[model samples]
Target: MNWNQFGYICRVKSSKTLSTEQKLQLCSESHLQIYKDNGSHSELAHNIAWQIAEDEETSQKQTACYKNIPDLINEFKFEHKGWLIYLTAVFIIYCFTSQLYQSFVVPQFVEMYSSFSPSLSATFDYYLTYWYVPIMLLALLLIIIVMAIIKLKNASSLTTTTPFSGMYNILLPRRLRNEYDALIAIIEFPYAYKKGFKATTAETIHFEKCESLGLELNDEFTVLLKQKLMSFNAMAKSYINKLVILYGIVIVVSVYLFVKMAYQPIFMMGEVL
Candidate 1:
C-alpha cells in the first residue's frame, strides 16, 4: 500500500560482518544525526529512512526506506533564513560605512583643492567636478551582481528548485525501480557519497538487474564499490563544521565593521572642529 518506494544497492566486503538490518540501521541513524547537525532537531525522522540493499545479501528481506530529500530541503531553507538576516545586516553596514568614509575624507580633499586652486570659489562645486557618483554607482552595481550570483547558487542547491521531472524520469528507477513496495527512505550520506551513491548502488543493482537484463557482477567492480560508503564520513564532518564556522565569522565581522565606521567620524570631527 506504500506507493512511495526508495532504495540503493551497496557492495559488501567479505570481512564486513554487519547484517543487512544492521547496515540499514547504521545508515538510517547516521543520516538522522547529519540532518540534526544541519538544524534544530525536528520530528521528521520518519521522512529520511534508507532502503539500502547489499550485493552479497540478495536473498535478504528489504529494509523500509523513506525519501526525506523534500523534508531535508525544507529544513535547510529554514536554517538558512539566518543568512538573509546576516546579508541584510551586511548591506546596511556597508552603506553606512561607505557614507561615513566619504564624509570623513571628502571635506579634507575639498579644502585642499580649494586652497590649491583659489579660482574655485565654491568647495562643494570643486568636489562635484570630480563626479564620485559614477564610481559609487559602479561599485554598487558590482556588489548587487555578486550578491545575485551567490543567491542564485544557493537557490540552485535547494533540492526542489530543480525541475527533476525530466532527468528523474530517466535515472531514478534504473537503480531502485525493481525494489518492491517498501517505505521510501531518504538518507544524507556524506556529500562525497553524493556521486558514490550511484556507482556504489550500481554495484548491487548491476548484479540484481543483470539477471533481469542478462548480466553478471565482476570481482573488480565489487572491490571498488565496497570502499565508497566508509570513505566519506570523516571528510563530510570536517567540511560541514568549517563551513558553519566561516559563515558565523563573516556575520560577526560585518557587524563590527558597521559599528566602528558609523561612530569613528563623529568622534574625530568632535575632536578636530
Candidate 2:
C-alpha cells in the first residue's frame, strides 16, 4: 500500500486498454525507475513495497496506501520519512522565529517606522540611525520569504489550504518533484520546469487526484487540472530558489552586521609607536 501500488491501482481503474501484464510491470518496474530519475530512489523505497505479491487480489485490494481526502489532507503523505521529519523541524523553527519576531522585533521596527515623518524629525532619529539599514534588508528578506512559501505551496497542489495547520507540508514541492522525476517515464509527460529534470505530467497526475477526490472529470475540470499541474514544478523551483537566496542574504547580513557592531578599530595603527 504505497505510491507504486496506489498509482497502479489508479492506473488499473483508469486505464481501459493496458493489459494485466502491462499493469503489473508498470507497478513493479516503471515507477522505481521513474523515482531514480528525478527524486531520490531512497524516497521511493520508503514509499513503495518493492516485492511482487503472490496474488492479484491482494495486490489490487491492498488498503495500506492513502485512500481518501480526509487522511490525505490531515496526514503525512511523503514517500520519505526523513523529509517529513525535516519539514516538521522547519515548521517548528518557523514558529519560534515568527513568535520571537512578533514579540521583540516588531515593536522595535514599529517604533522606527513611526519616525518617518519629516515635520517631527532630524535626518536620523535614534531608531532610524541604528536600524535603518537592518530594517530595509530585513523587509526585503521577509517579502522574499513570504512569496517563496506561497509559490512553493502552489507548485505542489491546487487545493484549498490552511497555512498554520499545514506546516508539515512545506516540503510538498520536494515530494511532488520526486514523484514527477521517477514516474515521468510511466506517465510519459515532459517535465515542464527544469531542464534535464523531468517529472510526471499534470495530464497524468491530475486525474488520479480527481478520482481520489471523487470528482467527475469533465472538459472544464480537465482544463483546470491541466493548468494546475502544468506549471507546478516551475512554481516549486521558483519558491525553493527564492528561499535559498533568502537564507544566503540572511547569513551574509547577520555576519556583516555583527562584525561591524562588535569590532571597531578606533585608530588605524592602534598606537603602534
Superposed by TM-score, candidate 1 places the C-alpha of residue 82 at a distance from the truth, in angstroms, of: 5.1
**Which stretches in model 2 have alpha-carbon errors above 4 Å?**
1-130, 160-242, 266-273
| TM-score to native of every candidate shown | 0.30, 0.30
lDDT tens digits, residue span 70-135, model 2: 122223222223433443465456546645654686465455534645322222243334544454
lDDT of each: 0.36, 0.41
lDDT of 1 by residue, 86-154 (tens): 545655665676566467855664555456434232534523453354345434544443443343223
Query: Which 10-residue span in candidate 1 carries the lowest summed lDDT?
Result: 177-186
lDDT of 2 at 270: 50
